[model samples]
Target: MELHRNRGALVLPLVCVLGGAALLLFARDGAVLHRIVGGGGVLLGGVVLAGLLRPFRFAIGADGLTVRLPKLRRLIRWPEIDALALDQPPAEQGRPASPRLLLVPAPGVDLGLPATGHHPRDGRAAVELLDLDRVREKPAEIAAALTRHGGDRFVDVLGLRQAAFDTSDFTVGLRGYQPDRVDALIRRGQDALVWGGTLERQAARSEIERTRAEGLPVAGRGYNTTQVDAALARLSGALTGDPSTDRRPTT
Candidate 1:
């Protein structure tokens, strides 16, 4: 893997420099609004610059590299792997299989994170099946949402019973989202929740993202998009640790 990419090396510094200059330039301007707007610009620029420098995406801990597998019962944490080789998946039931990269283990040493391989397809999507190891740390908020909007059908969220969700119970209002379409999407998430297969969480995540990005005509009456989006986001977060559809990581 390439050690570094310098895309932000120049642009970030330029933004910070320009923003600071603007802040100083407006410090002497008599009109209050100009100073206020300049201050806002400086703050926004600083925030953006901080974000550009924040090492969240580039940071990795000493746990080595953790890779979760399909049907995900276990994770392989490979350490001190210095070589990469391709590993093609064996076809199952006549369907295409995953093409992966195997981190060749240190020979005869056997002292480090165990050698592992993962499908390249994982890096292309939001649902990171093979990724860093970390607990989601939030289940009560999800359970509370299920209790509030899910009604009696959503008795136990951890149980993941699809039949417990009341997809058709939405109340319509002025200038809101299309109810039928939302219900159909909700049913898809329910199916994923019920199946609990290799693609179960992935399916729910896709549905949630699609719903958030979907463009529907404003009806005379329907469900509120904000509320629906929030609920779907929670469900997606419950399924996959990444919550916001808009905030999926880019590499």
Candidate 2:
């Protein structure tokens, strides 16, 4: 599968280029201020346009992954990859408001890909970043594709859990399971899905049972008992290796 660039992002640069040209055309010959502004606009717009116009290609094939960008172009064979993680970049003033894909190479193997920055989880590893905000494909789609092609290499750090629970809306009722307890248990289950191992899976299953047995605290305004129970049952099924409830990629 080949990811496509976000064409919508081109609007600003296009506007800049056009507006700059217009300013240059209408500026008075003797007006230094107008001339400076016009020239600056054109230069700024041109630089940004050039950067945007650079060829960007990301493709996944049976044999390897292909990444073609302005400064990097290489086919990373499957064997060279140790792990492919989806990392959530911190929300900042001038950062992409989307998760990035990290290409973590195997030990002693250097693909020479440029590093945009360091991921907290990957600390000091020479991992390359693939910004998803620039790509038109949804992050879930990309994750699915990577999981399908990369198999065990894909480590879902954040997207999988967020995708599963971020939109969960349980019916709020006067008498029901405590929202905090249910949410905490659910988070543990989700984390197990991401960090899969026999031990972790078993622990998650045990926790689900213990939580169910102990019962959640009741609150005046809480999630519906029935809905919460159903959700936990499904989560337990997923932890217990029930194929029907298991939506995540196998570790």
Candidate 3:
């Protein structure tokens, strides 16, 4: 599967270009400060546009995975990959948190990518730290693809239980399910998946059913109903051990 850069990321560069053009149009004649500001904006926007326009050469193939840079291209075979996991570093300053892909090579294997740090679970050194923010595919889609190809080498560090809730990416609307109630249910569902027995799982399932039957209190600007329901469906499938459900092996 070939992954492409997110088109949403192009917004900033486009804005910069427009702003630069506007400044250039409004600037008084022979105004050096205005000219500098306009030129800087255009130049910065152009640079970012060029970088984004570069082809995304990340792909999964029959033999291995391909990573392409401006001057370097390498294929990391399946045997060379020890484990692959997705990590979310804490948000710094005011920026929102973004997911990163951790590719840990097997012992004594060098994939040629720079090592950012060690994996949290096994303490194995990771060769590349890939930012998924600019990638168009959802985290779940990427995980599914990698798990299918990488086999047991793909580790779901971000538990599927939690991911069911986190990956919903629900939209806020004028009236929808209550946020706190939904969050509480998600936590209970996660607990069931992680540590609960059959009875607990059944109970969680029942609670979900009841919650849906009773309908969560609709508040102004809450999660969209469609998205929340989709997430709940996935959670229910996971609780029931549906073969189609995606989950980490308990062992």
Candidate 4:
């Protein structure tokens, strides 16, 4: 596989350069706000330039994968890799979302992250998936290289999940909203008798069962998959108790 750079790395520098120059040049005739903005611009320019010059880079090789982090570079071996996925861009569509590469390892590989190493699909191990965004100009080339080097099988995250979800749904409000925490609210609601605890627990159990059936590992305490799913189910159930008219089944 080849090394690929983020598209933002290039554009960020140009912005820094142009913006900093404009601010510095106009500082004399500027107000207090302009001076403050110019000072911030200078600092931002330095930072942006550094990032642009030394961005987070990844390399695909016959041996394994390598990431050039800001502090230092990390190398991963092939045997450590369990599942690999790539998010390819849309075919001749609107702006492309940045691609991602996920690497799920066999148990006990120690991906260095605290979470369980399950692949996102199976959710078995707390898998550490690497995300790469902002590169769309050479998608096919990147995909081909990744396929050739990283292996052929990859969950096409871009085409599958992204296409399925409406872009409009991802608004500022949604971004700020945490969907995972719906469980706590549901639990609170259950305690308040807004919904029965048994029903909420049943929903959680259903989720736990479904995840287990899919080979996903049991969700542990605190931000665990089970908690999130259970919460969602509880909320769903509360929202649509009467399915005949609701059409949307309650969790």
Q: Which stretches of candidate 4 lie over 4 Å from their true place?
A: 6-8, 55-57, 88-97, 113-118, 124-131, 134-140, 150-153, 159-251
lDDT ranking from best to worst?
Answer: 2, 3, 4, 1
Candidate 4, position 169, lDDT: 25
User: What is the alpha-carbon RMSD of candidate 4 to the true structure?
Assistant: 12.6
Which regions of candidate 2 deviate over 4 angstroms? Answer: 94-96, 119-126, 163-250
TM-score of 4: 0.49
How do all the candidates rank in terms of TM-score, highest first? 2, 3, 4, 1
Candidate 4 local lDDT, 75-157, one digit each (tens): 87777776675543221222233455656665578766554334434444443344455443354555566566667444544
How do the residues 134-195 of candidate 1 rate in per-residue lDDT, one tens digit apiece? 22222334334424432332223222333324333445578877666665566566545544
Please say which candidate is ahead in lDDT: 1 or 2.
2
**Residue 151 displacement (Å), model 4:** 4.1
For candidate 1, which ten residues in a row score worst on lDDT? 124-133
Better of 2 and 4 by TM-score: 2
Taken over the whole model, the C-alpha lDDT of each candidate is: 0.45, 0.75, 0.73, 0.49
Better of 1 and 2 by TM-score: 2
Candidate 1 residues lying further than 4 Å off, grouped into runs, are 1-169, 241-251
Listed per candidate, the RMSD to the true structure in angstroms reads 18.5, 9.0, 7.1, 12.6
lDDT, candidate 4, at 111: 62
